[model samples]
Target: MVFKKLLSAFGVGGPTVDTVLVNPNTRPGLALDGRVNLVGGDAPAAIEQIVVGLVTRVEMESGDGEYAGVMEFHRLPVSGAFELAPKQQLSIPFQLPVPWETPITDVYGQRLHGMTMGLRTEVAVARAVDKSDLDQVNVHPLPVQERILDAFARLGFRFKGADLERGHIRGVHQTLPFYQEIEFFAAPQYAQVINEVELTFVTSPQGIEVVLECDKRGGFLSAGHDVFGRYTVAHTDADRVDWVQVVDGWLQQTTSHYGGLRAQGFGAPQGFGAPPGYGAPHGYPTQHGHGGHGHGHGHGHGGHGRGVGMGGIVAGAALGAVGGMVAGEMIEDAVEGDFAEDWGFGGDEE
Candidate 1:
């Protein structure tokens, strides 16, 4: 909560800062409320501005592999042209806007463990000195996000891990340098389809982009390849989508179409080159990419995370179900496991 300023710039008896966030935990589209307390030095000074930034930890991709770093995702100016008299106290309250694509750091009231969000406050002063402060912030799931998460729990995919990765999904139009990947183990019905699944949600003013990747089983005489699918659901769909049915459909459609071919469904698959109809993913609503010939997509997590607990499969008659299904597990492996080694853990800096 303490702001760090260049004391040397202000000479001796320099002022100090501490930023207190009234509401650290918030949703993707919610606002962050906080106040910056500034204690002036022995001399009076003209304050230039107060800046707030949202910082996140993300993985970067490199030819040698991946790396990690704390990157500032967004910034806003809270105030400007102010004055702080000698030995005077000033408080600057601010409500910063959260980006629509902001990553979700928690689910079911559980912190993703490895994930961390910080509010950085920067104070600009004339000659006396300037200082900045950083405080931790927590991001909760959106209503639609919660609906989808609960559906996953109901469907029996245990949580494994979650992290942001550098690089595009071949066809995603990303404004930021990286994207977040929420990994989950497969349920019983979808077992034969593959080992696990990774979900990514990209949002904008218009709607959200849901990406699903499935690691399907190879045929009796063939090696199985991974298949991916994407869905464009609007915020209004939060209560409307039978996520269970929608997700199930996605899994089935993805596996059946991209089975072993080079096609990726709906969105771009890692290495399948690019989809014919889909443009970049960042500009999602514009392209609505998912499904098509997706070669060996860029997902390198494999099936090395954690073990799943026993859970019942989907309701009604069992379809072409196979393999032992996994229950909904908390994000144990994700928060504890080293993502940098497995995927793009922290590739944002470079």
Candidate 2:
């Protein structure tokens, strides 16, 4: 998508900027190619610099409340010093690298509800305010990620909702400030053992690390708690492994044990395998914040079609059941917010 904005910093007849992204759809570790088109106004202006940044809405937790904001995580300077005569036009190109740990915004061409990503363009003209524009960006999942998500559906796990949490997971080698949690409702067979599950993936060049936090059910006279399971899968495995079997085994092992697994020397027996509960030093702690059995909460509705496709990947039956549900209004809320006047981008000084 392209966004154009006038340089109101210089008042009427000031310069304007039109930022165009060749393609907004991309994956982690890939580069987004785009160009910044600038047009001079009535008067000649000395351009100081032009920059582009990748921004997203990140959820944050404070002492008293939780809030979300537009965070500029990656910045790229597109132009240095330049001069634009009256009616002069300039085009500067850029190749911005998407971070390896970037969160996934779309699955199988469908936007994941609750996720919002964008690119911001800032042009700094000498002695004037910086003009800015924002464009939406779609980040698709890596092949491995798609395979895992597909497996969940094939196993009867229903898509619940996804969100970015404020804090870093205890053991995750996190690069970004927040983590994305793709949630799912338990299938009928696993429902007796688990209420729901939250999934997270920390990706690197070598492989992707999958984290599963299952809301395990308690037996008679027992209280329910979360059982955390962590697994690592190589990208090459996307074409070779049976993700459905792998994911099913993960669910089985996670719910099969109420007592901690690491404590008993039991480790992850699925996927590429990491020690059980790899999110912590001694396995997952007993006190994870996600202890709620969140059914009937969040958007898993009709916003994005949970299309049933069965070829290499099988969309689970649960998705077909909830496929028609509407996405919640929260996604719109996340996209609609007031951006900062300056966005921390400095105006041209010379």
Please list the C-alpha lDDT of all candidates, in the order they appear.
0.58, 0.63
C-alpha root-mean-square deviation, candidate 1: 13.6
Going through the candidates in the order shown, the clash numbers are 44, 6
- Candidate number achieving the greatest TM-score relative to the actual structure: 2
Candidate 1 lDDT over 161-247, as tens digits, reads: 667775577665566666788777888877876788888888775567777777777888988777777766665454434556666
- Lowest lDDT 10-residue stretch of candidate 1: 320-329
> What would the per-residue lDDT of candidate 2 be over residues 85-134, giving only the tens digit for each residue?
77888888898888888888766556666566778787888766666767
lDDT of the structure predicted as candidate 2:
0.63
* Best lDDT among the predictions, by candidate number: 2
Model 2: runs farther than 4 Å from truth?
A: 1-10, 258-350
